[model samples]
Target: QATAMSVDCLGQRAVLSGRRFLYIVNLDAPNEGHRKISRQSKWDIGAVQWNPHDSYAYYFAASSNQRVDLYKWKEGNGEVCTSLQGHTRVISDLDWAVFEPDLLVTSSVDTYIYIWDIKDTRKPTVSLSAVAGASQVKWNKKNANCLATSHDGDVRIWDKRKPSTAVEYLAAHLSKIHGLDWHPDNEYTLATSSQDNSVRFWDYRQPRKYLNILPCQVPVWKARYTPFSNGLVTVMVPQLRRENSLLLWNVFDLNTPVHTFVGHDDVVLEFQWRKQKEGSKDYQLVTWSRDQTLRMWRIDSQLQRLCANDILDGVEDLIDGISHLPEPDKTLHPQDSEPQHNSGHGDEEALKEDFLNDPLVGKKTDQLGLPQTLQQEFSLINVQIRNVNVEMDAVSRSCTVSVHCGNHRVRMLVMFPVQYPNNAAPSFQFINPTSITASMKAKLLKILKDTSLQKVKRNQSCLEPCLRQLVSWLESVVVRRTAWAFCPTLLSSL
Candidate 1:
């Protein structure tokens, strides 16, 4: 029986490990092209993963008993590379680094996490002692030197520079953790699935508690972040049923799944998202099950579009007003004495109906009496506005809006002159203190000013385009700086 499976980063092939043999299938023609490579192992394979950095290398590792066997694919056959031999106990999980192609991390039941340089397999380059025996390990996608390990009911985050200690520890669940993964877009965010029948999202920077929790009646085998969005996919065994348990959820809203994939007849051992093909709008989800079969589920444009809308809608519900608290509080506020509508506390049903009836349902920027062409272009930007507070000054013909992006907040103050959208340019300034560097802040302001002047010269609206440019700059800078800072000193030491 097959116990472990993984898809390569390029999504061209998949590898499945059984009791004493490895099977390789070309995803393009899965059924017609299948090859089996025999291995000398008495027990079943525990875990497997392909090298995620290089497409031409085609290297993979398979763990069994107390050792991990490395293999390279060439001409439809797997050739044995060196076997890494350091763990005294069974190897539980392994992962390749996102930035460094030769770096690999492995966790074992020996209560240790080992980082190895595949080029020199004599011994592990770094060893981290864990609080308990680890069952899973995953590298952060947005951070090069940061990684996480799951042991017992807790998850630990480690910086490669300080291998002797963990940077943060979170008591995630009451039972053993089965899976752990970092968010693709955010460096501090991560998700964990446990045998305790719940999946929780956490921000390591704020370790006091989890951000969100999704409770299921059955054990969730794995929970992973989607490649292109904030959605999550999980494989679980439903309360009384043992089949068809793949579910997709919007992390912001746990009330319901956006879609459920139902094709597998037995418990799914592992599943991965295939890289989207060129010019293809749909994404493929591949799964291997205990029923001795592999299946692929296609998520079309309609479903993806719905998932995106659902994310924005959920954010609107969570943070519609400036004073809206993320969590409910029983303590009364002074503003509660005023009328509900004026105080931004209208009926929930009425708010929902208003959102449904709004003409700008899927738009990023709200209507501001701009031209039709300019309005459509501004709406096409793919940025999520967590919260917005607009202050309008009719006497001065000015507007100040505070926008929230991931962990960074920005405030924009624009003053429209008497000859706006005709000849004179609007004055723009960034008011709030952002965590970004001074140089980045200056660059953003310069871009905003330049764009505003260009719009004025063309005799068009400027606020919408300026906001869109700001969002784009914020996202790019955050992702790049965070990933660079995450590379530890140990990488240089090596």
Candidate 2:
């Protein structure tokens, strides 16, 4: 299997591999180390999304499936998808809507909108959109069913009840609208970009012709809604000397530039607020450039990060402010220090049991503080295969990670271009299998065996594939940690 990309939680690592498949590589190092627990590969992953609330389960969109699939591995991974089906056009974007995780939407380049009762992607309870290119879809944070979209040069908003209700229609720009997003706090607010020389915002519920318009020197690439509720962030390509640059503005009035992010050598394709750890002091900004580079920009100040965070009415709120959630619930007005959720927080027995039972959470918590309700099932990862040492064919550019404990041989041929990073030393990485023995493959197979979190099970079944389950795990292997914790420093950058 080939992976176009992969993403993992402190608990489970997922590989978005080709052949339209996803492999869950259970890991422990939210701080310590990554190891494989179990894996199940299914569907052709066009898009894969994790439940922001929990890491064990996830959603994937595929062409053959023609539905949004949900999975939960707790009770032996099976399709939670017996009833859920979404989208008619090879489901494009599937996400637990930011405002409500229960509500799910999927779109295809084919002009159709299918809103499914997330429990089942197998069917769409509501639908909309005309015969046109439906490039993007987004819901108004305050108003769930109200959707805004970009189709060529038109920007339109539709209410669920009246799918035909074009609450706000604008033949806004001459060229295709490339980006559209809504401010979390401001209902009826919309920001969009196109080939036009300007990025514009509109207040649909109001009578204003255009809420505000900021000039763009070049055709804007894409613009995102800033965390400031009503502000907007726009990316544009600069003339010859450079390919592109980004601009941030307060769309509420659009009179002044709040921030300008420069230094990108190519067009910054997209920008997003990397939701920081719930209670941690660290804050980050991410921008993906066409130059095939992902740059991590640390928001210079703590207060600055708070200001750019996605809290409505902001961090001063007594309870609703997400960034300030770790503090006491002023709404309840506790008499002393805020009580945490753990039943016996300091009880070593309970903690030890929790960690042993569910190593995923213990490790996933390395830096990204997890939500209070999160929990997981127990798993032993990386059954270390130390006996049959790694046999690397260095001259052939063949590098692999495997567990060669005596007779068992489970391995993943790694394809990282060895020339990228500084001090890219060669070291053997094992998936942290479990209980290695002389006949390692068989014992490892039994442990690696897994099924889909969804209900549908392919007629095909075997125990061997799990040998090299094709998963990635996280481990607290960092000796001297820094801001860029996960990626190793490349000699090129060194």
Candidate 3:
């Protein structure tokens, strides 16, 4: 049910990979002029990608089984131009070089990564072996020779120029990596999502520790950087298989997603950005779901602003506002503007100085050392934790947390002060429906108070962590009681 979808860099068309066919749709008019190319294989396409060059706009690649097919489409006709075959096992993923139109890379379960030249489909031009099969392969957008591959929990960085071994290695995760993405602007930076229920950012140069981590309640299916602003898009595998899980996040503020895209009745299989057209301020996100539907959402300037980093705000505003300014008078002769050119150059320096001096320009940033607001913390809290329920009222600065473990039930009111999470802890009160005794309630209250104090002293959000602690404590209590109740009977039977 998970189909692969790819949008061409030109943004004029998209290709969807299906079990028995490949469907190419005109993005500008999705309901019309669509063509489906039949696949004669039992193996579904594992990965699909469109060539990132404008000149090769009609060219795309799809991987099936151990082979990869290159498709060429023009006007109303489309067909497979060639097939690249070398891997001994199933090919897992493929990617086209961002800087080279003729080059394509494929990774396989055969423990080999092959780089193919479309001009010569007889054999691979270069092959790199990692001794372990790779689940994903991605070409660096900023560097043509650089590529990265994910092998289980580890990542290997490769430079095509030197194919003998990985130039750098990172123990990225403890579980299988589901997705790998290179930063659009930085060559050494990348993000890896895994079954470990977290997405970690890496500089690669310093592999000992991650730059930042985004903890999630469910495994992240994919994490990718947006082409505009300091934004990131993540696809999560929710516990309820078909729940809405597409989220748009600000990279600067990782505590919460800026917006969540809801509407898909089933899980989203793939998503890609529609190339932003010239003179347009809006970007579109195209997604394909397990429900067998394709949906596109427009991201206007207003949404883009929410993802903008404070340090980049001034630059983004300058670029967007330049076109709105009136065009200079072309009627004036070149000789008539000589004095104005000199005066204008002088004014430019003064304007730059004034811009820098303005207090409102590039002065605010995410690292302002301020604690998060109650509403922001509430937005960041995970509501899907098992056997736990939290009802938060931001206006009242209070929340009711309920946890059920075995036959025990706990319902408590957690009230926060005005200066919460800034050396100010919330007070927990056991309420109706609580099944624990007075001694147990007091113990739980002390644990909750200590947990909240630990985080508040550091000016951090503690509500979610405290809730998780409550669940763990209750489960331990239940397990101990069950063991004690059955221990004597087991010994007598023995």
Task: Please report the candidate that would top lDDT against the real structure.
Answer: 3
What TM-score does model 3 achieve against the real structure?
0.67
- lDDT (C-alpha) at residue 187 in model 1: 85
Rank by TM-score (best first):
3, 1, 2
Candidate 2 wrong stretches, greater than 4 Å: 1-95, 206-208, 229-231, 237-241, 252-256, 262-267, 278-282, 290-292, 301-494
* Candidate 3 lDDT over residue span 422-450, tens digit each: 79999999899999999888867866786
Clashing pairs in 3: none
Put down candidate 1 lDDT per residue, 26-69, tens digits, no spaces. 88766454677888778888988888865535999888888888
- TM-scores, all models, native as reference: 0.65, 0.50, 0.67
Backbone N/Cα/C clashes per model = 0, 48, 0
Q: On a 0 to 100 scale, what is the lDDT of residue 129 in model 2?
A: 70
lDDT, each prediction:
0.69, 0.44, 0.75
Q: Deviation in angstroms for 460 in model 3?
A: 14
Per-residue lDDT of candidate 2, residues 347-393 (tens digit): 00012233334433423232122112111100111122122223344
Sort by lDDT, best first: 3, 1, 2
TM-score of 2: 0.50
Best by TM-score: 3
